[model samples]
Target: MVSQVVWAQVRSKAGRLVERPVRELRGERLEEYEAVWQPPRYQGRRAIATWWRPADRARHVGCAHLGALGAAVSLEADRDVVAFASWPMRLHWADDAGGYVPDFFVRLADGRVRLLVCRPAGGSPQRWEAAAELLEAAGKQADWQVHVHEGTADPVVFSNLQRLSRWRHTRLADADTARVLRKVFAEPQPLAVGVRESGLPELPTVAKAHHLIWTRKLLIDWSSPYMPHRSLVWAPEGVV
Candidate 1:
């Protein structure tokens, strides 16, 4: 009989598992596209607009936490459950496809797909709410999962989460990236009296966060970080 231990050990290492070939995202051939169905809407990159200068640090730290958790989490702060392909995953649904290319799209080894939506602290709550509504409607039809997160310094808005289930708030230890993002994600308002009473440090911009109306955490499997971007399935180049 084949030794299960050997097989398991081999699979644990990158480039050792015998599996299906991975595809990359390149063009317009995503599993789904907004232009084909709905009119696009957007004026700028959501991350830069939302978190502004600190967006990259916010995303890097978030992805690092996700990586440490050993889940298949990709980065995206917008769109449906489809994975964002990049560091600061901002979701976009364009009616005409006349904006920046998507940040990144991820395809895990297990074949699960999700979209990432990054929301900055102190953005137009209206837009976030509108996007949440669209995601809820689209989720039922597309059978996708959506994950939303706020930059560390931003407040996690809880206004429209009544419809979601199993929601809980948890905080992770701040990392280097979180430290760098402090200036951008930090809020201008004073810390709540309660927060001060608890003896925590004054909140930084990286301290604020909001939950996107999503079912579960967005994921990207990074067991094999050394693998070339082209080796992965669902790369940007492969999308079209």
Candidate 2:
């Protein structure tokens, strides 16, 4: 005789269980497990992502505004983070108040899931403290770390990142172009010379340089305001 377990595996089009009569369950209501929830609506001033999520491997698309603060977090997460989500899930805060959706959910290389929110540097303490307390309660319930980032990002650095990220989706230039750039950077040099020596048009050359910098094939002072012409760049040791 076919067991009830075998019969339970058959599901109908509407996600209802196809009940093949079995001894263990004669008239039991066959209900399928619920499907994954898709949010019916989203909140926030919508913006498209320039970067990918490390955790879910989801390619770029629309998401909540990263602005200055969120932009800073995105770059760091790409480097040190194991994975992250931008407002991926909702956490219910209380019965009366609506659910809170964190700005980011990061899983660090150290295996911690951190919930992060960004606000203005001069935001109200009382409101933020209340938020922190609510997040603390939420953390206790879900066993995750909750953090708040309250500040404006450095204007120069942030602007430079915005410019550089434009080349992130660009394809690498030719082999000869890459070779010339590498040879120029065989010693630390102003990126301008490398761009000129590539013999490519300045636009494409600069774009290639941007890609190289983004992929870590080249290094420069990311600490300060970045200038394409005068920025010093060096290839990793032994990099041809």
Candidate 3:
């Protein structure tokens, strides 16, 4: 079956609209899009405009709703994501059916680009499925990845991510304390035990430990409920 052609429109940094065929977008051009794109303001019931500062990037990202904000938090927690922007572009069908503004554009550490759509769980799955089809087709043509993220399936994990994000800022990191943590958690141990064994002052060491976990220098069972004293923590393989 022949795939439908897709085109993208984005606002440039100077506030000019620029349109291009999806097939033509790749490499350095993606960065240009990120630099220029701005998220649209949302209005009406449950609509909100908010900003998030990701640990991996120095700038604040705008989110259009709670779901988009959650998606941004998930992106921030992902170790593989190098950078991301919300509402980066609008995808239009060449046939002029309509257009969609995807919720996020992500640049991964392995040099892959992804387009993301955010929807609350229990929303119209059929509608989002159709949107995913169009976006995925565009992604294929552009050599990009695509996803439609429903609301958090695991509240435990999402809660844990939120907790860790509080410590995600680089300002919380202590190199000396991190080194001690890496060795102390070289073997799997409870969170409080590892922090205490670091031999630093309790308060600061605990914060640094959480920061390391946020940065993925320390690994935890994200699937499990987080506990300050009981949750297990360990360094990734070969870290010690």
Question: Candidate 2: lDDT over CA atoms?
Answer: 0.54
lDDT against the true structure, each candidate: 0.28, 0.54, 0.79
Q: Locate the minimum summed-lDDT window of 10 residues in model 2.
A: 1-10
Ranking by lDDT: 3, 2, 1
**Model 3 pairs in collision:** none
Candidate 2 to native Cα RMSD, angstroms: 11.4
Q: Which digits, one per residue and each the tens of the lDDT, describe model 3 over residues 48-167? A: 768888774666777777788899899988878888876667887877646777878889999999887876456787766667777888889899988877778999999999888899
TM-score of each: 0.27, 0.61, 0.81
Superposed by TM-score, candidate 2 places the C-alpha of residue 44 at a distance from the truth, in angstroms, of: 14
- Considering every candidate listed, which one attains the maximal TM-score? 3
lDDT of 2 at 103: 61
Q: Which is the leading candidate under lDDT?
A: 3
Quote model 1's TM-score: 0.27
Which digits, one per residue and each the tens of the lDDT, describe model 1 over residues 179-215?
3323322332222332343244544311321121122
Candidate 2 stretches with Cα past 4 Å from truth are 1-73, 109-111, 120-125, 170-180, 199-203
